[model samples]
Target: MSKFNRPDARAAVSSPVKTKSRASGRTYEGAPGHARDAKSELFLLAVANMVSEDTFYERAKDRDDRFTSLIHKLAVEDADWTARLLGWLRNGAHMRSASLVGAAEYVKARLNAAGTRERRTHEAGEGPGAAAFGGDSLAYRTTTNRRVIDSVLQRADEPGEMLAYWTSKYGRNIPKPVKRGVADAVGRLYTERNLLKYDTDSKGFRFGDVVDLVHPVAGSHSEAWREWQGELFRYALDRRHNRGTVPNPDLLPMLAYNLAFLESAGENPECLLDTDALKRAGLTWENALSLAGSKVDKKALWEAMIPSMGYMALLRNLRNFDQAGVSDEVAEQVAARLADPEQVEKSRQFPFRFLAAYNAAPSLRWSWALEKALNASLSNVPTLPGRTLILVDRSGSMFGAISQRSGLNRADSAAIFGTALAIRAASADLVEFGTSHRPVRFSAGSSVLSTLKEFTSMGGTNTAEAVRANYRRHDRVVIVTDEQAWSGYHGADPLGQVPANVPVYTWNLAGHQYGHGPSGESQRHTFGGLTDAAFRMIPLLEVGQNATWPF
Candidate 1:
């Protein structure tokens, strides 16, 4: 085969985002930029956006307003598509606050549309309410709104969380669609264990509050199950008022046991429950520690609580474990779970979380385990054949925290993901760019965390110059950036230096309204998220398949 005609030499052409020609815009840094269609813009922003959290270039309210506006537009234009995006945002992309906020706006827009239709029909003398609105289409919209609301409420606490958002944002006039959707979710999510774990005083909307508002009935289930749920709901309500009575031991023995233990523990602060007793009572670490008070040894308490700790709880408390002087044996157990592939998958934690934990931990003991966990979390990142050019943006605008509480920033996220891709690829060139650019050298099998230490905060985003400087004859180019490229002497495009034939992937970490380059076209693609799942699109595109929205 001729060198140019070879299969590997040909550029992989695919459309990862389906939108029209990009329009002209400007970056937050005042660079000439390209604007994406509403759907494309919303998808990119929703994935990385922590609703109400500010980026370096955008304030919290501004970003949140943009997000809500896009969702509101799309929610009415294409309800099915919008619904799918909201569901995936919560479950697949693992964006919690954004999904919750999106779901609320989605329903609000749909309901407003429905209301408008009803008003028009009544004004035309069609009838009243459902009759005036035309029942079939109205029912469909209602069902869709309800499903979208329920889809995002995956966790037990999310029902209450969604309620809080809806009430706070849209106010006390909670629509039936929101209430019914929450009720459906409550039926599925509410459980004795969840009540014990999340039904606490700290949350504004407790389990009892949700039940009171939604009045959820146990959906179609066995009679025994319904009876048990009824008792559970009533108990939740009572618990909020400090008048909860223990359930019949036969129907809810576990809850009864836990409730009895809590009551007894309240009476005797110095009582130390054994591990077996704690497990049997289903006592969470927080409850256990609170019940044991200051009398119990920290190390002993953590050791006993380790067995019952969820994956996230364990990951968060690794520092606490080290501080408490947990024994090496207990540490090994925690490490085993942390590194377990099944446990990691079930945790549904973002890859950045492992990085955050790794950074926060004080001991070297957790270094190896965290490394493995990080790798496991990024299992979707492909090991591409041939050479690849990876650019990570470490500009000033990339320094904002991903969430208000997160210590990690978009820069750290870009480096972590870009480094991981480089380390995993067969042959790669890793570079970090800001005002200037330089190659980040790392030997094969180097730790992602260790290689990250070599990267520093570069002053500005000279994306065009960086790509021009680093564009060798590579098979593909992946730039992990906020896409806030600085306008060169004449506002040069970042990926313009690379030939249009070769594939260029823009991993947008900031979800800015404007992009550094045109996307949704052949050989130019854009993806955004805090997870490695989007990396799977590369291999798909390489094999002559069009990558569609991940739902």
Candidate 2:
């Protein structure tokens, strides 16, 4: 067979994104750029976007404005598509703020469109308020808006959060669709345990506030259950206003126990609650520690909290556990939970979170457990059949914090993912690049967390040079970056040097508007998210299948 005509050489091309477009913009660093269609752009941006948080090249307000604009446009253009995206953004992608913001904007835009249509019909002298009050079109739109809003408000606290975002941004005027959607969510989400866990004074819109505004009835349940829910709602209102005497111990056991605990703890700050007592009272670690005050024994408190703490809480407090000198026995129990695959999956933790925990944890005891958890979380990162080149962008711009409150930045996130890919692949060469490129050394079964230490922040994004210098005859290429690559000396695209027959996957960490190379078709593709879920598309594309939207 001719060299170019061999089975490997003549690999088939697959289109991941079907949209048609040409390179139409410049990257932040002046590389030739490709523009994605509205849907593609929004998908990439929404998955990676930490709402109201600044990126290296984009301001917080500007990024947020762009996100809202895209959502508003898409919400009006294709309501069903936009609704699915919003739903998946929250439930599937685990983006809380973005989904809430998107749902709010989605309903607002659709409502505005309905209002415009009604005005136009009224002006045409069709009938007075006929389009607004009696049209099937309006009804359909309302149903869609309500469903989208309900879809995003999955957490018990989210209905209140949605209302808070809406009132803060759009004002006190809560539309019927928004109210009905929130009401639907409240019925499903509200419970005694949820009230105890989430109805805190820190939130602007509390459970009581949501119940008052939306007036949600009990969800599908027996008459007795519905009556109990009514009592729960009333108790929530009374508790919020500091006028509640006591919740019924039989119906709202958790709330009743928590209230009793708070009163007892307030009366006697020095009295140390036993682990079983704390567990029964459903005291969160924060409240437990606060209540303990100067009499607090860190080790005793942490041990008590460990059993009741959720997986995420346990993962985050490893450093605290170590600092508190938690016993080896207690540490083993924590490690067991951390290393449990079931627990990791149930937590819905982002892969980068394990990295954060690993970095924060001071004790080496957690290293192996964290490694196991990290690998489990990255189950979506496929093991390719042949050699792979993994490029991690360590550019200056990639160092911006993912969220204002988070210490983990895009640089760390990229490194974690790139390293995980390198470690998991059958045969892989990992490279870190910015102004220059070099192979990152790792033997077989290298630790992803350990390999992260070798990466440093380089000055600029010389992506084209990196790919040109490092493109061996590998089966595929995976570049983890913000896509803000500068033009090479000859102004070449970053992936231009690689042959089109060999697939190139861009794992975008920062969702800049313009990509460094053309993607969404052929062997070249782009995907973005804090999770490794997007990596699942590579195997599908390699097998000559089109990779559709994740949702």
Which candidate gets the maximum TM-score versus the true structure?
2
User: What digit string (tens of lDDT, one per residue) describes model 2 on residues 232-257?
Assistant: 88988888888946999987787788
* lDDT by residue for model 1 (424-465), tens: 899999999999989998977899989999998899989989
lDDT of each: 0.86, 0.85
RMSD of each predicted structure: 2.5, 2.3
Report the CA-based lDDT of candidate 2 relative to the real structure. Answer: 0.85
Judge candidate 1 against the unseen true structure and give its global Cα lDDT, from 0 to 1: 0.86
Which residue pairs in model 1 clash with each other? none
Model 2 segments more than 4 A misplaced: 1-21, 127-139, 267-271
How well does candidate 1 match the true structure in TM-score terms?
Answer: 0.94
What C-alpha root-mean-square deviation, in Å, does candidate 1 show against the real structure? 2.5
